[model samples]
Target: MVQPFSQSRVKPEQNLKSLSSFNEAVRLLRESNSIVITTHINPDGDGIGSELALSRALRYADRMEDSKAGLHKPKTISIINVNPTPRNYQFLDVDNEIRTFDETRDAPTILQADLVVVLDTNHPMRLRTMEPYVLRSNAQKLCIDHHLDTSNFADVYLIDEEASSTGEIVMKVVEELTSHQIDAQMATCLYAAIMTDTGSFRYPRTDAELHRTIADLLELGADPTYIYDQIYDQWSPNRLRLLGNALSNIRVLYDGKLAIMTVTQEMLSATATTDAETDNFSTYPMSIAGVLLGVLLVELPDGVKMSFRSKGD
Candidate 1:
């Protein structure tokens, strides 16, 4: 969810007021007890982090209020994502709480939820496995995202495309809604979203505010060394082989303007690359200086899945 005036040169504070509905959405989300948090299908770090971080912030704020008011309004937090996230985020807080859609699981009913915080995704229908439950949920919906195209389905939308990732947007949103200062764990979670989405700060989307946000994250205890060591530096040999096979098929097209790489089913079997291992393989071609766009075609059982990336704006 992005604010309409997000791309303007106006200060974030001024732009923040541009979306007057943001606070309203936050308020509505805060008042609810039974909550469901979700994101788009084929979840990314930004999506997963924003959904989880927002959930934790809201739950903490409500519990704190209960403690102060002497009314134990402990809320039930159930996070249901369309699909599981990559192995990289397995260590983040509340990762275990993230449930895939299952009618049989005694998971809290979506329709019964007092609120649903949809993060990092504009379109709810893209939620795939969680669509049935989401449609069934009577919960008031709020959206927080930075994507360009968004569904206005949420009762309230707080979208800002200027922000590098939903994690960055959620950071500001959390700051506004809670008294808790950003901690090491929270910084790590938010940093993961920003780091991955911004191409480790090399994307054209990176801005002064993004750098400032990261500086604060580091001050709050984000360790780039550790993050890099795990995310990229520690790639397994099989993962290397998987990329090798895919790169072997890369083809230059449109007079070398497009670098296309196709991953067939046979390639997956040959490298023993699990679905998780193939994550982020599409980014490899961006490292090539002459390529303007990188295209990855992954052969699924039913059809081919494509991931497109471009260096040009």
Candidate 2:
């Protein structure tokens, strides 16, 4: 079984290594005049939240620097993603800064930017349609992510696999960039990112430090109740019915150690719900008594998307 949160503290050496990357990344941000930020295709809460929060923080820092130097030219920052923001996460983009990538328009921006910041995923392929452009760009690339097995595409990498989410790592960077002056909007985005990726702080990597970070976010104006409601409570009636259908069809196997749930295209059409509505369906199977592993298989037009949730190592 996965270890308890109390037993999963981050190692000291990991912090030191992460700090070095952080320093390099901050220096690059300070020098860049124009920047483009993006996340993986079909982004989850962690990716979207980190992208928005980091972009906002960078712009805020630029404005502060401009005021102090009496310079009107602030760094130009654009958030371009391969896919449109999910309906649920649209609330966090309060300023509506996120733009769906258009090759004709965004290609030039990517090529012209002094820096390109890729959040959440480390692999360039995860950027999908934007991958070639990102690779072709001469801009200094910086990747901020929490996943393992990173590609060497970026000029600077701020990666911490031990982090609960990319949002957690971005929180530290935001603090350093803004001098601990995180605003309410940024706090809300980070809170949503960390909360969702940590499964509401119940995941294995969640620990005292993570909770402390959450507390800091709350004090900075992240409303947990509101964010939770916005993300989970806003599900459509058809979406809830789709979940019910999936639960009803769950198949138990291996003497109750495994549970499998399948959502076919027919099921989706019947319920008038799309595949995106099946985000957390795997969690339901893992919640069953005596089940060690849960598998959610969603059949799309082209292929099947599989999600796994397991209780043990």
Candidate 3:
């Protein structure tokens, strides 16, 4: 039998505070003329999805405002990133709006923008090559993230540590800005964001309210089965062989409490797979019985990349 999931309720006071922050973020969007939106380097579903969703919502709002006021000018919004979108996530950017940063072209736009919005990551360092440009920008900075231990860099921040993903917060912002009018594209982007960050709604923070929010997304045209297939089921044959190699290399230690898997460069070369293909490989070790901690190490040309996952507190 399936058991009911427990809830992790946010305090009423926290809701009020988050509301206030959302309102302030909306105000900044209304005031800005040119906006540059970016996310952390080696971007994941959460970052890329949030960026696309927010960008669409902002454009929708601008169109409504322009129609109301009989104006011709629309706000300039650009989605720039230090790294290109991962292959699995490229489908979300249907219009191909995301740009891989070219300093000469993007630096001028970042510098001259009226606002710079950083999503899914709070710290500037996470922005990698784009960090210096963001820091040097005279534009008002706004950060929308659910990560903890934020740096004091952004001029306005909407950081909700209790939220499941940055997509959850961006959804609220989209709701407020567009008056609950989210289209299918925005819904798909947001669904991908929340789904990936919450580990398909199985993460520790997947509460009732988060499910309700996801339900709302479904009504707005987010196809869960399709999105899931696109994200997790689209692996190449080579990638599956790579995973097989990793699983074969797993070793148990410390009385079977720890499970470790390594994906060496040789294996990657032989399988014709890259480190990105090993995104959730750490979960495999944790699937073993009696294993409390799972670790995945992938060897790159320069160094070894490590991923860790644990079962409990």
Candidate 4:
């Protein structure tokens, strides 16, 4: 039987006002065993990248020769998510460690976890179908996210909304956990996280420190060109055709202040493309000369899905 979250044995650290929150988070993670890592549903690069990076870092504990170094490694460190990794991001799963959650298959793992680290999201509902199990689990919960919403569900919150990405927050935690010597695998994941979230380092969050971090990642064996190619250059003919069809339907609204495009089931079928092929398709509308806001309306079987992006503010 899983324990209730409120009864967690770990006491909150004294200094909630300072970096002690981070220190305490690190302490809880270091002391925990049977750890399970997860992120939000339909995860983007930041969520997936952060999950993989932290998973790799935690796995390092098992390799440590010194058992007395206070590396209280869990017997199992599982990376599970509500949805499958996007086709393009599959390259980062070098270890093939990410598993999709199934109620029958993964509920036991969730229930048995001594610590559940939720990355890139703070709300349990963001966990989708896995929310109930995560909420009921007696394990200590830790949230490492950059989203503005800091709704207090997790026992430990390592949130920095000002940070470029959740990957940035995870980088700091990983460094603190590993004594600042991150492995190449960690670097690749973090690089992907920051890269996608910052729109290839052009977003407002891309500061000097972020550039330095990217430089360090490059020095530590992250192949930026290869990563970019894998994510952007590998589109199939069907996907391109689908994009062409969607773009043809672009509609200017609010006197060019908004650009709207729709990808319907008929268009997808005509183009021989799956819905997954439309991932990040909203960027196309935003690229218009005078568009300030871009919207992509995807026609799902049950409903219409919408995504919005803005030029500024």
Instruction: Decide which is better by TM-score, 3 or 4.
Output: 3
Taking the candidates one at a time, how many backbone clashes does each contain?
9, 0, 0, 1
Each prediction's whole-model lDDT (CA): 0.77, 0.89, 0.90, 0.84
Tens digits of per-residue lDDT for model 2, 1-313: 1111222444655655556678888889878989999999988899889988988899899888888898667889999999999888999999999999999999999998999999999999988989999999999999999899998999999887888999998888888788889999999999999999999998877878999999999999999999999988998899999999999999999999999999999999999989989988889999999999999999999999999988876
RMSD of each: 3.2, 4.1, 4.3, 6.3
For candidate 1, the 10 contiguous residues with the lowest summed lDDT are: 1-10
| Model 3 lDDT per residue over 173-276, tens place | 88777888899999999999999999999887788889998998999999999999988899899999999998988999999999999999999999988888
**How high a TM-score does candidate 4 get?**
0.91
Q: What is the lDDT of candidate 4?
A: 0.84
- Put down candidate 1 lDDT per residue, 132-234, tens digits, no spaces: 6676678888888888987668788877767778898888777665664666767777888889788799877798878988999899898988776656676
Alpha-carbon deviation at 45 in model 2, angstroms: 1.2
In candidate 3, stretches whose alpha carbon ends up further than 4 angstroms from where it belongs are 1-16
Q: What TM-score does prediction 3 earn?
A: 0.94
Comparing 1 with 2 on lDDT, the higher-scoring candidate is 2
Clashing residue pairs in candidate 4 are 34-74
Measured against the true structure, the TM-scores of the candidates, in listed sequence, are 0.89, 0.93, 0.94, 0.91
In angstroms, the error of model 2 at 172 is 0.8
